[model samples]
Target chain A: MRVGELSRRTGVPVPTIKYYVREGLLPPGELTSPNQASYTDTHERRLRLIRALLDVGGLKVAAIAEVLRAVDDPGRPVHKVLGAATERLGARHAEHDDQEAAEAGAAVGELIERRGWRTDKSSPAAADLARALAAMGRLGHGAFREVLDDYAEAAERVARADLGYVDRKVAVEDLVETTVIGTVLGEAVFNAMRRLAHVDASARLFGTRPEASD
Target chain B: MRVGELSRRTGVPVPTIKYYVREGLLPPGELTSPNQASYTDTHERRLRLIRALLDVGGLKVAAIAEVLRAVDDPGRPVHKVLGAATERLGARHAEHDDQEAAEAGAAVGELIERRGWRTDKSSPAAADLARALAAMGRLGHGAFREVLDDYAEAAERVARADLGYVDRKVAVEDLVETTVIGTVLGEAVFNAMRRLAHVDASARLFGTRPEASD
Candidate 1:
């Protein structure tokens, strides 16, 4: 197949295909002449894989390159590749498995304790969260363990209820990442979206939409 | 307060404060002398706000600046700021909205109509999910409406289950954001973690933890 045919088939531009070739993300087609080349099924598959990684997985070109290499490497364990990808994702913009979550929990816990908060152990964040704190302590961020544990408990409870709305649809994997990112950005998005919702409703009511029909 | 004191108070470093001042994010202190200028509580508060916007909100500096300006502006509706921020978060990133969720629904719907997929309107991904598609339609990413709604349905289900685990501990807002982020990353994490669990179990069965744990 020609590059144009590949482009037509994949909906990717010929120029972008050329760029991919230049970047070594795609192997060069067999040159029939200076301006003509032949492609193959392998090229189509590679392009599809790249598109999936970029579009579906949202990986950077460099990260995609690394992932492709790992995927193709015979010596590399698929588990390791998966692990690295997950860890990389979790560490995006926010550190997962770091002391921050634990510390945040502990800080709130100590404050609650100082304020004579009736410590609720039945809370999702109470004991196991304290276990996370102990893990943080072993990791050397022990100062705010207890306090962070308390906050973790509070955070856990609220998140659980919020998630109740989403539980019936997604797979377990999608749920976890969405929850993490949602937890991190959802607060901001929630407030922002809520405010925008009010604006949208008001605008529809006062500025755009017709009055309610009886 | 001196830069050192400001650092201690805000938990931001002197170097970072200097960078912020240089970047015009913070107004420079009144110069008592070239060597020593004092910061105020306003500076500390601004720094904390900046950190929260950057760290917790994951906003770029330019976006944060706009948000801060809108927050401070009495004339502007708060919702406009929220909309701007939400819009800045692209629909392609699964880290934020369930673009995949919406897309999946859309895909299924299209498939059912075109290729005769066994889609149920009463199915979790079919009914109210259409509302999400409608919302996305209004948002101008009309092409992605159906697929994104499908993803949302799936995500909503996962969120429900995950939240059930942490409901006793967290606050509503915190829980929502945490779950969103957690589930997004957790999806990836759990898959990886599950594999890791298997690997670790295999290692333990084969006696590899003490020698290879580090």
Candidate 2:
């Protein structure tokens, strides 16, 4: 197929496809002649993945490029690839090494020790956790840490389910991409579910329906 | 105190504070004299909340303004305020009224019925859930719904913890703000913890350390 057909099939504009090719997010098609190139099934698949990451995952082009590099690199371990994909899902911010952030980082270290997790304290995910906690502390909600264990328990259950689903994939080659989709889109699924549950729980507790108030 | 003091205390720059005021996310200071304005303790608290919502919550200024309006409206029900705040946390996209989206919406409706949740299907959260499921289906992961119950269970646990914390607040006036904070920042906290737990669970399952692979 040519770029025009690819664009028509995927609903992505031709120029955007060319832009993705230019940005190294999508590979260029084989040139049949001057100004004529052919794309394969793999290109179609890759283009869909790129659209999913950009639209639903809300990843920037540069971050998507990094994630794709990790995804395509066979030398990288599965867990490392998963880390690269998941890290990009987080809000990118400069690390604040202030007193509160330091305290929060120490607390995160304690949580890791208590949980016996085998990840590094310097990991971006760990830093994100620290930043969130520090922000909470600044807002006078420092006691939110009291419920960390519950969140961890829930997280463990969700992670188990996630890994179980990924492990069931028949092809080893499909594992990394499946993991990336599960992590990014799965977050959206869980967040929406949480909001629905919040409505249900709040209604049960308050004896008032949210829609009724609307 | 003055606007300068509020800026110093909250660590928000004066120009940004002025921007928030101009955007209606923060109230204007009381004019004490020509070219001099006084901000109260309420101003300080609101400034901190604004910064938290902007930085940690990742809400746009317009959405923050709407949420703040809901929070300030004494006539609005607590559940309504919560619904308003929670709805804004989702990615605001135009609803895809295609067949797959309709099927996904039906599945979400069934999940709500099965779970006995009290929210309407028309809610933004429900629509967001449908959109996520539809996206997953497009990605060949429609079976992701197989794990919805697990995600819902975890969501219920977290929501219960959230409501319990809010219920413990001494002032009725503070309930809405607390719910917004819990919904937004609590999500960041849970996501980080989930990633950490993923590292642990994947390590145990694969017998490989993530950091070792790094």
Q: Which number leads on TM-score?
A: 2
Q: Count clashes in each candidate, considering only residues at least 3 apart in sequence or on different chains.
A: 82, 0
Whole-structure CA lDDT of model 1:
0.44
Candidate 2's C-alpha runs over 4 A off are A94-99, B212-214
The TM-score each candidate achieves on chain A is 0.44, 0.93
Per-residue C-alpha lDDT of model 2 across residues B91-209, encoded as one tens digit per residue? 77634556678889999999999999999888988988898888777777888888889988999898888887777742687788888788888888888888887888888888987
TM-score of chain B of each: 0.42, 0.94
Q: lDDT tens string, model 1, B1-214?
A: 8889998865677898898887767778878888999888777766765664455434567765554554444443422433333333322332223554466356446633552222233332232234333333322224432233333333333333343433544454333323333322223322322222323332333343312111
In model 2, residue pairs whose N, Cα or C atoms come closer than 3 Å (at least 3 residues apart or on different chains), thus clashing, are none
Candidates' DockQ values? 0.10, 0.69
| Candidate 1 chain A lowest-lDDT run of ten | A188-197
* TM-score for chain A as predicted in candidate 1: 0.44
